[model samples]
Target chain A: MRNSIDTGAVICSVFAAVALFGAGSLLALMGYLVLKGLWPPMRALAALIFAHSGDSLLSIWIRSLFLLLAATLLALPLAIGTGIYLSEYTRQNRARELILSNIAGLGEMPPVVYGLVGWGALAPYFGEDRQTLVIVLTASVWLLPQLIVAAYWALQEIPVSFRRDSLALGATRWQTIRWTLMPYSGRLLAAKTLEGMARVGGEAAPVIMVAAAWPDSSKQPLHILPYYLYRSLIEAVDPATTRHFGAALLLVLTSVCFQWAALRLRRTGVVAGDTLPGLRKR
Target chain B: MRDSKLVVRNLSVYYGDFQALRSINLSIPLGAATAVIGSSGAGKSSLLRALCRMNELWDNVRTEGQVLLDGQEIYGPDVDVTEVRRRVSLIARHPYPFPKSIFDNVAYGPRLHGIKDKRKLDEIVKRSLKQAGLWNEVKDRLQESALNLSPGEKARLCIARSIAVEPEVLLIDDPTYHLDPVSAAKVEDVILELKQKYTLVFATNSMQQAGRVSDYVAFLSEGALVEFGPTSEVFARPKDRRTEDYITGRFS
Candidate 1:
């Protein structure tokens, strides 16, 4: 017993040290980025906004925001519908297994491949002038599988007891889904949505391929933050280094904010005693 | 069994290739508590779920049987499943109060059946809670989320929710499975009181609880009925060796 206790204490100390080290590393990285990169770009953006100058950087950031929103709007319904169909409507059969495996495979594929598909197959049909449209389409497609998977897992996380209870109360299957399953899974679904948005927003490769394919077009190229950051890094001279860091800081901040919101929503749901896991506490 | 509320004839349940319950027959007496006592995986839950056709909700679960509710074939093709469920309500092992107000949880069933009058709904909610012996505890906080209630109160709330639909037969599957002893006793009191108005069939693992709460006790082992009779008689003189051994604490 003495040896076991000593071993256990040593294990706990090691785990504690590991956790503190990981947390310290993350905090240091964030602090470095904020100090080195955040201030200059923030001041420049503020100045441009105050002067009413259409700075190319501000416009690119705005375009990036618009693309993110557009992709989210386009993908949300399709993902939710497909998720509901897969989880609620489908039986445990070969067809469902096939569809799920294929979706898993699609989720694992890189975003650049989607960009290539847009550039090669879709650009000729829609022409090079529709850069925003083509990019949104490809980005939305890339976002679909991940969002659907998130939605599916969120819905699945709800306890089966809820479904059984609702149906036992004379609720029809659709009524059970609407009244019980959907409401209970709402917070989880919203959190997944925000996380998906962050992921798609930070994706630079798809936007790059589509945008670069039409550099010589007469239309003004769509300017997004990820693409601009990529260009700044690739062409990094003495002056461009700070710009690259600034872009990285902004992207990281956006993703962190989204993740923070998701965490807050999930935590509030648990604390408010709205979930089954919370209900088990008593 | 002359005035049976429900009659099960040759009931069997299967989950894909595995059989959960073999062909079994039993009669549930009207306006009395019948306890189906067994160890885990002895098909007690399957039998309860099959009575209300709740087993059909799960994937790969198939039931072959005839459950007669007041002599009407419940599994008949022409029957409306929702009506059957409403008539024969079930309270699961765990209390699953909707993430809604206490009043709303009780009113959910009535609203589903198209009870729109606010006064009528209020009356039903109050009456059901009172019937479940929970009105005094939660009357002041009708709008509070049901999830905020204690485990015992939540169990009673579930009972209230079921009775709000005014089901003829109340099938409770181990209502005290997750409760402390004090809470379990309170639930047992509610069950004893409820049997006066509705036909009660419950599944439990405790022989003591079965003796305390049920008028009739059916002992199940390995998906088959070992012995069944009045609670006193079964406890006093178990006919089967398996039933005798189980009651005497030989094996769970």
Candidate 2:
């Protein structure tokens, strides 16, 4: 009675095939990027990740990492605090409902719109210091909704019984969060942080508005890689496409590494909550 | 009144429009196991949760009249809910272990109470686990993840976690409801042992379970108290026909 296959299976399979096709294109793009990164004119594939025209590739990367990390750190507490308040403190009502819905909607907004807003509002406040400040502010706002949403869902996924249990043990609301809920959700928190960084790596529009005035070769020590690649493709000043490919490849490699670390963290929980059956052996 | 650890006078609870508990009056004696028995949706859990103000965790839940613990009114405005919970702890229906090693889970309560001295915490964890009857089994693996323990062991570990806080009253809500028989028996035994040191109020639907673990019994039906008396007297001679019928299996 339970395992019978039916027309539903065939219908779902058709959609699965379509989804798989979409994934295949993404894989093809990645392979192409890798090929471009590794091939001849790019010779020292080492040069791609290590050094680029005029600037140390490592410096470019370190700057990008700093922006992403700083922005994420800025957003982390605010987002996690929002999540905790929503999950434990606030009562369910029209206001809470509105806030949650708005957060979800924020995730759907265009990144370029954020770029425009950053250009207009933040451009003046930070004069020569504009690029770093703008990127940090834009990246934080862009990432806030995502991390909070992930946190909200993560807190929800944690059994409510855990909260009750903590309280019953004489813990205050803050204690319940610090001792019980936070530890239980460590993996989720880590994964979402990585996801946020990858998003910053991939999004170039916001970075363009902030850094366009500064030449890529100026080595002002700031970046959003996709935008730099875009500049390389369009501007005649940099005829060699290899550098763009190299940078793009480095970006991909870093994201892949972060995802790998996240996966490993999930497989072996940093704290002692239950794990998936597949992860039990590890 | 002085002897009763908790006294509920004209108490009523509501969730928005619907009243979950009608005006009810009962008293729980000090340092004894008082079991509130009723069918599902019978307000047994509502009564237990109200004892420690655990109901505050949810939305739109409101309480009327007085729930006096010792002598202080728990539901009164301006009374800190955290202090009340420290005095009155609840062990929910199912096992819930924090995402930590077994030792850390038990140590969480003491650490919360500001017992930062490593030696003091170690002692508390050991005593609590031993009292919960789990120290021997888990001693070798105190640092092991609490999640890896069997379901029965986790339930006991939760009890150890609660006792480590040194609460004055223990509210056990359906102690063994979802557990296997052996686990249920073990949890029942732990509750029995617990009442020796802490005043306990247990909520359960099964009459037989109430008989096994309670020193006093409070029978509730349709959000109202049907009967309240000592376990021996309540089970032996019920003044209310509903209580009698329920105990005799004539009705639930």
Best by lDDT: 1
Error of 1 at A189 (Å): 1.7
Docking class of 2: medium
Cα lDDT for residue A49, candidate 2: 56
List lDDT for all candidates, in order.
0.84, 0.81
Q: How many pairs of residues in model 1 come into backbone collision?
A: 0
B127-217 per-residue lDDT for model 2 (tens digits): 9999998989999999998988988899899999989999999888888877899988988888888989999998987888899888899
The digit string of per-residue lDDT tens for model 1 on B78-172 reads 99999999999999887678778999999999998889999999999999999999999999999998988999999999999999999999999
DockQ top scorer: 2
Model 2 whole-model lDDT (C-alpha atoms): 0.81
Model 2 per-residue lDDT at A221: 40
Task: Label model 1 with its docking quality class.
Answer: medium
